[model samples]
Target: MTHPSTDTATSALPPLIKGPHERRLGVVALVATLGGLLFGYDTGVINGALLPMTQELGLTSITEGVVTSSLLFGAALGAVTIGRLSDAWGRRRTILLLAVLFFVGTINCVSAPSFEVLVIGRVLLGLAVGGASAVVPVFLAELAPYEIRGSLSGRNEVMIVSGQLAAFVVNAIIGNVLGHVDGVWRIMLAVAALPAIALFFGMLRMPESPRWLLSKGRNEDAVRVLSTIRSPERAEAEARDIRATVALEERTTTAGLGEVLRNKWLVRIVVIGIGVAVFQQLTGINSILYYGQVVLAESGFGAQAALIANIAPGIIGVVGAFVALWMMERVNRRTTFITGYALTAICHFLIGFASVSVPTDSAARPYILLILIVAFVGSMQTFLNVATWVLLSEIFPLRIRALGMGISVFCLWVTNALLSLYFPTIIGTFGITGSFFGFAAVNALALVAMIRFLPETRGRTLEAVEEGVTTGAIFTIRSRSRHR
Candidate 1:
């Protein structure tokens, strides 16, 4: 059976009995996205906390690196492991498990008295962060209607950045006001627990992914869940389409690691997924997020000024994400990716030039570099970051969606882990000029790869995209002239 077009399905379905369903969906999306918020705060809090933490714990530079990267290491494992677990157990259950882990991990970080114990805590938090990153967007996508999936799934990224911004603001306040207090860093670490608690409580009322239920041969339950989020007519139509796609796949061998490797088209798409995941990090975005204060200080700002300056990028990041949400509905994903890279690569070049051309002692040098950095962050948020996560959530076939996403994001977290571990050394060895110049080169290559390989998924249903993937028609599908 052929998949029905979303428009035709919606048209044939009854007029949406709007009120309670939309509100419920909105609430579910909000509660589910709390995972994104915790993911942000836990990862970003360390930026400012690490300095005071070092003094309190008597940490060496090596130990500090270990503490910072340990979370990333844990996240890589979480992305893959939790992804597979979500596939087996279900998305809602996996996320609920992550919520409990977030609470426990935050408590560990807040109470730890030694560096070794703190690293252990960070590893736990990392696992939660990684799991959320891998699962939350897909959860939202699976629950959302095809027409609104981009915006709904993309909201998780906005929440992620918002969480990061909240961490920056909180760290700034605590760092400046409580700089003299004993263990001020503990306060920063402890604040994350609030969201963890919120996530756990919020998820209790949320629904499981309907697509997942359908996958498990529970069609009635899938329709029931879908009805809560969709109009009655739309719900039944979507259920029919999903069942058709699942039945088609069941006629063939199951998709797995072996199947992905043996099928040339599947391998091609998986490689594309990995490439986007890697290039997203290679843009040098996280290095800035994880170490913005350090980068600013190196640009010649005083310690206090550098801490305050870090908040600028965070502000612009949120603003840019709003722009991205607006654009995701109108623009093609491939176009957005290419535009983001071009803008960021140019910003990277200007940052390098400003660092070298302006004398270190000049009053304007740091401010100039700060503006360029903010521009880069804004460009990245507007195009690359949100679009990348949304595409990852939508691109894979239903059979291996979770596993494929886990593997792709696993590579992303690994790249992020390596950079978080060695970013300081890169700066120490090459200085700002060399480091940003390298980012420029990497982004240039990224732009080319996006143009050649990235398929546009702006207005298609997840099932429709899966059909294209299975038939190898995605690569040949031209960009839609007008977004629906």
Candidate 2:
């Protein structure tokens, strides 16, 4: 029989308690988020590392594209493949495996004597990065108390951007201090292994996902694990809710591939999740980061000055992510997403309108666009990026959470990779005006799609989320039930 008190159990979580229990959960999230740090570092390091690497490796344009893009394509592969692996093997074990991959990949890149070897090493690291991207937030979400789950899981996004900022700073300092050193890029590659080492050792002491355990019928183990993170009273209550939900899923949810196609809710939620993931990229944020220098140069800045100015967005990105984290605790996620997408769309339109309206020779044109680009970056990091990841982590039912996240993120990467490959050609053919106009259109459509399909996820337990999402009840405000 269900305990009457169990219904109010989730509400028992005190927001921002700052107690020992909160500290313990915070530590676990930090340890796991090292994967995110590695993700950011590995991706961003290439921005600076590529120049020196090409000088030493004798890379042609085609090969250079290959080297720069190998990780992205590899990340797409890793997100899908490792995502399934986590579902079966478990989130913690999969992350530990990712740690090993990160270490091996870093060493391989640092030691590679040829372009082929370096590309191979980059692909290996991409797998780890993609794996971490999929699993870390999910791991944190499962362990977090509902009251602070948004802030807690959001730490991964903060770490990712922070890691990117760290890479930019590290690359700048190392390249300057040892500007003449041979193979300095190798030293840059070597820095990632330290965090990988930390992630591996840190996760060793962490507990498995209690929700995963509950789904697997390890009831006592689930409650025991929860006890460490939650007060004993709340742990028992949350476990009961999870147990009941899992049992219901076992009985009613049988959507294999063919069945999934037949099942409207299954198909709808998966499709919605994929769209949500892809929409984040369609905002043209990654396209901007990838080609910020090109945009700056077109604005008439000198190469070195453009290079330095580009860091402004990266710095603002980090600041915005922290703001997003603090806001995550206070704001509803749907509100944040719609607000962000709307803001970015407006910024993109203004950029397009300005690019055409203002004379290219005008001195103020560059500064005007620069401010707009920074605002666009700020809006994205502050609202869309972190929320997208956090939403991806928690939106699916437990049965298909990793798989849903994997496929969605795979599409997200594929979209990002596509933009990266073709963005230069886009600007070449249509110039900045046409390209950003296209971006504005895409974001506008995305905003509508989201408002129509996106569900409110704030202040819900994983079990509550699973119930609402799978049944299609979450999309309708009044239809959604509050767990508390």
TM-score per prediction, in order, is 0.97, 0.93
lDDT tens per residue, model 1, 147-202: 67898999999999999999999999999899999999999889988888888888
Candidate 1 residue pairs in clash (backbone atoms < 3 Å): none
lDDT against the true structure, per candidate, is: 0.90, 0.84
Cα displacement (Å) at residue 406, model 1:
0.4
Candidate 2 steric clashes: 0
- Quote the lDDT for 268 in model 2: 83
**Each candidate structure's count of clashing pairs:** 0, 0
Over 1-484, each residue of candidate 2 has an lDDT whose tens digit, in order, gives: 2212223545654334345666787788899999999998898888778778989999986677678778878888999899888988989999999999999999999999999999999999989988988899899999987778898899999999988888877777787777699999999889998999999999999989998898778898888888788777677877877887777878777525565677787788889889989999899987766667778887767766676777888899999999999998788887898899999999999999999999999999888989989999999999999999999998888888888889888888887777776777788899989999999999999989877778788877787777666666776762242221
